[model samples]
Target: MTAVEPRTPADPATTTELAPAAAPWWTTAVVYQVYPRSFADSDGDGIGDLGGVRAKLDHLAELGVDAIWLSPVYPSPQHDNGYDIRDYQDIDPVFGSLEEFDALLAEAHERGIKIVMDLVVNHTSDEHPWFVESRSSTDNPKRDWYWWRQPGAAGAEPNGWGSAFSGPAWTLDETTGEYYLHLFAKQQPDLNWENPEVRQAVYSMMNWWLDRGVDGFRMDVINFIAKQLDLVSGPAAASDEGSPMGAQIHDYLQEMHREVFAGRTGAHLTVGEMPGVSIDDAVLFTDAARAEVDMIFQFEHVSLDQGVHKFDPLPRNLVALKRSLARWQEGLAETGWNSLYLNNHDQPRLVSRFGNDTEFRYESATLWALVLHLHRGTPYIYQGEEIGMTNVRFEGIEDYRDIESLNHYREAVEQFDQSPASVLAGVHAMGRDNARTPMQWDASAHAGFTTGTPWIAANPNFPEINVAADRAAERSVFRFYQQLIALRHDDPVVALGDFELLEPEHEKLYAFTRTLDDRVLLVLANASDTPLTLQGEWVPDDISGAELLLGNYAGDGAAALRPWEARLYRL
Candidate 1:
């Protein structure tokens, strides 16, 4: 294959290029996220790979998700679970060869399913050739590719910025005698986006991937691409949530658009993972007319359940969640789009976090599905979320593989001097490993993920929660998700309707309305295990002749909603 030539920087003279006329298919599509290392393991290497993902494409197609977002499959040191990319162009040997990746891409495209890659340009593995060269000598031509700086007074670090993995953000390179900035792990140095050379290289790599057959990208910590030029120290905090999303980010994104994505013509999808973004920031970031990013994964909704510590299980205020969702809806109603999600590789399983993981597991899973998919956004389903997967209670930290979780445990117990039991409890409650458990395909040894041991333990409840069991059951959570995906495609109101949340003050019931072209759809859900009194804005008489499009339990009255029940009524 011919290499993609580097394109010249975009001239400000022709910057006001308008987006395409019609909305693209992603506007209504539901994306399924595949954490490749945990999704499957065909090679018996105890880790999942591209060949494993290829074998499961049928499952995604059957589940009805229009696209699949496969998290970082590039060559990496497996530090931070493949996010520390060593090579931007080739498939990891652990995953498969580039030939196998090409086959997977071809097969997915042939099945009408778009493949979205996890683009990790914020940093690269210290072992990457560029990083190695940069650290080799201060006089190296590529030394400026990364953020290398001088030590502070008294041989102190460059800045007080903290690492996301619980350490100083800057690491001193002994060979160069200069510190390099790393927003996350020390092994993953932050790229200097200020360099025009760096920007050209990144844009060229993106074009190379696009020139190949992938459909889109889920950019990792994209907002952190451009940090404050001064590199000022921020307030000291235990956890480094990375850099703040600043105003300069827009300029960088616009430059990226003009160079890498300008002429794509709405054919590809882009979702920026903006950690510090508020509703106001998201408006400008995801606004279609701006051509910055097609959508963004916001952190506010997911962080609502956490207090100062992620493990402290604070009672999630239902009203606050409703209000927050409403705020984003109103903020992005005019020009921007929203990407709705409940679970992901970095987050704990939704059933355990937000829903009843025990008695009302299936019902709560179905309930949350309706609430999110019915909203005015493209819904994303994490792997095993369709089967009502729950969190695991691993007794020791040695069993966990996440860098963030392990670092937090060490910091809490060793540095901050917190109780081991309390920190362990926190890991049990909020560790990312909770969602990274091997996919439970059947009630077999190792959950049929592999005949060999899995890299991580499969959830012990696989006997009850496996996909094979759901497939045979009369009504399963998987089936409900399928219906939700189908609804987005079959019903226009589900995709483009105006959203109105009802009963924001209700503690146990989540209700909302979606209106489009005189077609009104009411989505009502009982969020708890026990039945709750149904009294709110919508009375039983409000829509006397509404058609019941879908529901989990049988009941017809405004007086009471059964436990774990939800219904979609079209009036």
Candidate 2:
């Protein structure tokens, strides 16, 4: 296959004059994320499948979501959950068949909800035929398909760079006497995008899916796909600007757009998960004229409380959080777009991480929902998030299911000389397993996620935090989400308004205004356990008799906001 040259996108900083005829359909849409392994199990096989997702479509429809982003369900060895894909075009036996997935697509389309598939092309499982052929011999025909290097001096690793999961990124194959690079787990070898054959093959696979009626793709670790061909050592290897990396990534994406999605119909959504991406780069990636992607998932706000290492978390800082999100809002105000989300499959539950999840669970959950939904972007709600799901507290490391958490525990305890108790404490606070637990549907065995044993245990608090109780309660987070979704659909200002962050330096209050033409929407929330009175300057001049469109509290309080109180007003 001959590769086509792509047209470069104009610089976003100077391209503000370029504008589209109208906003896209997704600006006002809300997406729901479904982690298939934990969502529901229709076959009672201790795992969720395509059938389970099809059965739960009504729940998503009732919640008023416009789309469902399903995490990877491709065939895999289960080394890194479903991300280490062995076959790109087939479904895993554990997750049902291709026919089952087709049924799901047709059913979701019937209800006016689009289905977005998780695209994990950055790496492939070691068991994949491409990788297996490449590793068979030293001079195999497909040896250049993946990054393989000879051992360094004294038979050490190719470089000193560490894997995202832990240990050196290069794994040695005894048979070939060469090392293959894997940014994540050793079971997942990174594909060499430098090879034109590799790039064309990936594009072919993507086009196959698009032709099959899938809506779009949520690309995983997309920024890391472009690598330094020199095989440089040290931390700088992950830097943004390089020969085949950084800015060059856009070229590959542009070519992919022309090849796979040039004439695609439907309101397809494309979001790239780009870590360590700066705002300027994000602007270029999301600019409409770029044709690279619709939006990118930036990690600035989520990394505010993270220490040097991800597991070593620091205390949350409200002031820093506000500043980070504000910067993104202003950066993309003119030329680009944003993807609003608090937590996803790779992180802990948002209610437990950023909100009080205990004494004020309902209050804090609803408050966060109100603040995030009203932002000028497409918001994504993870499964179990609408019902105020809390994090799980497993007693031991053995109870965990994520490969990252298990590897960190071993290294921290044995190599770093840390105590098992201390490592377990960190895992409890920031482990991926916290987000991988079975979804809490009702107060039954295994939270009604599975009739048989669950792949991982459900949160012990499911008895009170399950969907059944929230639907019946007078004040429920699920119902609050419904109202927010409806508001976005009914009001144009919520989606097209210009964002102006107010009181960004304030510690306990998160206030912002959305202005479109003559309409102004104000969102105020007390992100703390204690009550707070709005400072005089923070209160707008048109607040005398503003209509309260939505609020978490029962009755309108006079001046002070109650604990975790959030209100949306139209002035």
Candidate 3:
């Protein structure tokens, strides 16, 4: 593959006054994620709504994020927390009416913040009208819209594939005497993308949203849209390595682009949430020439610390993490793009999972922010992450609200014969509920997230880690994030530089450089609690005259880095 040249600063007079339309806005923009159910609640309903998000637009605007990626707010039964959509074009009553959503979108655009809706097309709620019609009878016209397979001998599941949440992937529809496929929970029945009508319906829905003024879409489990129809059994060890979806994913993506996005005009950002995607696959998925998508959210870095199952986690190793991230930076350098993130709605808090959340919480949070924002990708900041929110330590299964966590607990303790305490420990460490806890707004009760009871319990540490406290402090994690966002905007190298990893084998320190022509930005981070001196080989020759752009600790030029300390230098 030929390399795309790095974008360099040009003379103002020589360049056009307006940016070329061919260049997508997301290439240099930062996106902030808001899990609506936890961001803020209005009407004292103990649940967040579009009104709540509208009320909090100022907070996002002040954060300097270019766009806001909202988790699903579509109509649903609240099964799978709105990911199981019953309606594509309407807002759920639990959230708000379409009028409220319109107001929110209008208000967000007024503040110069782009709104990116979560596009969940891999499946729809089993109660969806389409699915309802499909299951009404064997001869229903919409029956082929979803995967409906007859059971094998002894009325067993059609295949041996397991649901991501738990149990067999196929659920029997008593009315039709056939099993329908659901990769996730049974509430979310997989859509049959092989059916041209199903693909057209999805594209039509997308066009409706784009017509409604949504800036772009964050496609959910998009790669899973295409599945093998052979109904073959998967590996007993539980892996999706050779899933049939891989065979026709690109074709479907290209078709989607042509049908829904081909002639669309705007700074639209399209990102596919792809799991088990390789670097080579990502390049094809995101290459401009392919016209598939603007970018993709890859899982390589996040999967490094996982054990047998996602709930089971291994110890964090900075060397492995650095190598994983650097590989992506290099892989997507010329032909593709990367979506940089440490945590999202379905992942644990970054501070708790990968950094120190206790003694050096502030340092670790700020250091990690630098590492991610300085990378050559669009950085996505999850809600509450800017203020250093730590993972929740729910005492029992009852305290958790996520279906995935609940299902894991039941299966681990009942079928696997694992102790409740053991499963609870893993759930506390890696459960999605950790990231779903209400956003910490202030030190007030419920972290000022709601006046009524919260849908899920707030983290006990909210009082100390809330936004109000961070704003009042002289130096805080929120402020560090603000600085990083500013740096990315004011500095071109952050968005367009070529990346080179330094000391790839170093376990205690993560060092890298981003260069665009003569401008060089060197980032050195101490990934451990103990202080250590910078290794000579890791030091660049131009460091002596480089200006200190930012640092967690006060220093003019420090040879030794403090615990979890990080410094950014511009040469």
Candidate 4:
């Protein structure tokens, strides 16, 4: 298939703008991420449930998003929220019944919103029946369903690989006298995709969801499923772990497509989350003809702030950021596509990590989003991101939830020789719990997220910076997001325009241009707290008849960018 390159203008002096794409809805789609546990509580329960999300479908539809990418709501032990699945086919009671899910699908679709369910097939809950039967005895037929290895010569772990949460990835199964691998928490055991039975089981579950009217899947660690080789040592310090770049992962994905989705007639999207994936690898993963996944969530940009430590603070490298994104843009321009997001449920809030959350909080959050939506890809807006939501502020480690943070606290201090106080501060700054705070809807007690105590506390600043307040204000983040979403729907430049990074050496400014035919859209963002004079062709005098399309402040191409300001223009 030929790549769809943007049409060039016939003349350099006057560019003609192209109309919006009329096919392939996702090419310019905006996806809203709903962390069901914190979105809302319909039953007055402390925990947010499916009914809670159902009540808020109108809010999503009004936001102008094309789809909602819900986090996992499958039955689990709640060890890692719902990522550890005890049952793939049933809904957990807290999230309402399967009938309620059907209702949500109907309601969202009624409002023209597609539902992309989170698929956590990389691992299964240890409490799951398959894992239980596998652990019952070494001779059990299901024993090979999960990775089980005999102790090494010294009775050590199967290998030196480490769990993402920390420590060895293997846990001793005393009953079976073997070690089982878990890339995440011990409660979440890695499935052996090398086993054909496991492959069929996962594919069957996927078809079940599709038959239930689900739109697509946001596959959790899907690329890591094919660990076709034996577990082995990692780096000097880390333990053995599974990576998506495993040689046979391609074959597994292809086989899965042939078995599960080849005959599908509709736009059922699939996005794989690959943390360390390269652009070359991503090309194959998302190639239109390859029939694997539609796109992938790459972690290079998010990891830029961390050193070896996830909590360690490092200044954002603007030049590196530009190159990282540009490479993905160029590499996939022909064969694949991109999934754009600055923050998600597992990362720190966008405004808190990359924007100024103090005086210029509104400008910075809006600016960060300005850059995100302009990229040539499917954009994801995480829950609470639309209204400039900042990260949480918990006074003590005891107040923090999520095993990822809790485990880090223990291991970082004991094994990593880090100070307890410093680690606590780091967790406060960069922990996943920061993004998991309950959504701030109104100024009522607990942000009106629940009638009773909330599963997590709402941000204390909710009164001044929440949906109710933003919706009421003349100029608010919520309104800005709506405008951006509308622009993508109305202009083909946003969905299929060619991307060009401008001023690659600028320190405080991130500027880029998008072109489709004679029309061009220029985006200038001040990523810092200080002002920067706009330059290059984007300066008002250089481009004729440029009109400001979106901006955080009342400004133009001729005006100086205020602190943390972002502006978009069309010429």
- Clash list (residue pairs), candidate 1: none
Candidate 2, which segments miss by more than 4 Å at Cα? 1-21, 231-245
TM-score of the candidate numbered 3? Answer: 0.95
Q: Give the per-residue lDDT of model 4 (tens digit) for 80-120.
A: 99999999999999999999999999988877788999999
Q: Global lDDT for candidate 1?
A: 0.83
lDDT of 3 by residue, 292-399 (tens): 989999898898888998888899988899999999999999899999999999999999988999999989999999999999988999999998999999778999
Worst 10 residues of 4 by lDDT: 7-16
Q: Which portions of model 4 miss their true places by more than 4 Å?
A: 1-23, 232-244, 536-541
Worst 10 residues of 2 by lDDT: 1-10
RMSD of each: 7.1, 7.2, 4.5, 5.5
Off by over 4 Å in 3: 1-23, 231-244
| lDDT of prediction 4 | 0.84
* lDDT of residue 363 for candidate 4: 89
**Cα lDDT for residue 415, candidate 4:** 88
* lDDT (10s digit) by residue, model 2, range 379-439: 9999999999988989999999999999999999999999999899889989999999999
Which pairs of residues collide in candidate 3? none
Candidate 3 lDDT (Cα, 0 to 1): 0.86
Q: Estimate each model's TM-score.
A: 0.93, 0.94, 0.95, 0.94
